[model samples]
Target: MEERNRSASLRRALTVLDHVRAHPGLTLTQLAEAVGLSKSTVLRLTAPLIEAGLLDRDRDSGLYRLGHGALRLGQAYLDTLDLRAVAAEESHRLMAEVGETVHLVVPDHPHVVYIDKVENEASVRMASRIGSRGPVHCTAVGKAILAWQPAELLTGLVLEPRTRHTITDVERLRAELAQIRRRGYAVDDRENEPEVRCVAAPIFDHQDAVAAAVSVSGLTSRITAARVRELGPLVAAAAARISSKLGSTTR
Candidate 1:
């Protein structure tokens, strides 16, 4: 009976991953209905996969999608998967052009994790490490991914108040994300840190979902509000280049 249960659970997990991959953004109700399982059962089966990094949950909006682990696995199957290398080269060029720090981040469990960073010689040094995590509600890279995410996932995120500038109001955050989507980029005006500012844009995968975010961040003095406005398009262009390298035809 235990073995049978395990097999059934594995099947459910695979089904969920397939559905999420195909749909890009599916609500729990929608997933449950599509999988012919109860909502509770779908949630239960997905929990372990999510914990294992094979699936992702949008806490803000209660949506489920394939996670980075799945992406890694897919990349592994390919003989020539060096997008990150390409991204790093592009990031270096962007940093040289903008004279600011460029970062590449991917969504982790409840936050975005910096995967890579290239700092410009004249840019103010940052406190972030390559593996460090940042809150999704306050950072430009996080907002860039969140803005393009499914509504259900956004609604389901737990908005803990981390700081005075942290956005704790869900409705307000949703509005802000909507604006980010419409603007095609996101800005951090000391939202995450008192004297830091950033501008970010989303990187799309071949599936056209937000796979990552790339940004330019620095001290507010160097990356002032006016500078953010100026850098927004450049950041967006870099993101577009990265996305194109990843096989996104959106640009």
Candidate 2:
């Protein structure tokens, strides 16, 4: 009975906080009505939240609002989130839907580092490993992320040739990046590896900056140009989901 009462009190306190967060500057009476509690009970509930710095009450206006404690808690959650773990579900789903290997990579300035890979039993195994690095100029995942980055970053990039299809010309690569931004995805038609093809999309962070990219990779025999067009939107949608999970408001 004692424990049950404590749990109820905790729930009530949290409810009060939620109400204030949704309707900031709410008066004591308004908050009570919102949470379906009496004025006195709401006041008692808010006492703890106010003391803990999760809420603030305006002395002159008797209005309630969220406090710095809420910001700190939100920041703590964002800081603890791991990019690989956040993108894991979408990466696996993309691989399952496409029947190809999926890779998750993060920007490493002039390159992208593979941080995770997902594939099924019959999926074509990619040469990429979790810790391996690929040039930003030649890999689909790399180009996907670079497309959203600051334009100045492109000026300093060295467009080295990886294969005959690789875009070694800076002007052409710039045009390719523009196309990627317009289409919401990027494609590597045997540019990184002569026999491999890939389609990738950028992942955004809370600030709407490109934080990473997700890609579907397979042999040229399986992932042809037509197939890339089909997989482009699928990969982009998967990356958008991952970005949403990371607190991105805009995809």
- Which candidate has the top score in TM-score? 2
Give the alpha carbon lDDT tens digit for every residue of 19-39 in model 2.
Answer: 888799989988898889999
- Report the error of model 2 at residue 183, Å: 2.2
**Candidate 1 positional error at 24, Å:** 24
lDDT of 1 by residue, 1-251 (tens): 99999998898888888888888788999999998999999989899889888899999998888888987876774446465686897799889988988999998746999999998766568889998999888899999998988778775688776557778888998999989888789998888888888899999987788989999989887887888888998889989998988868777
Model 1 ranges with Cα > 4 A deviation? 1-79
State in Å the error of residue 72, model 1. Answer: 18
- Cα lDDT, model 2, residue 124: 60
TM-score computed on alpha carbons, candidate 2: 0.79
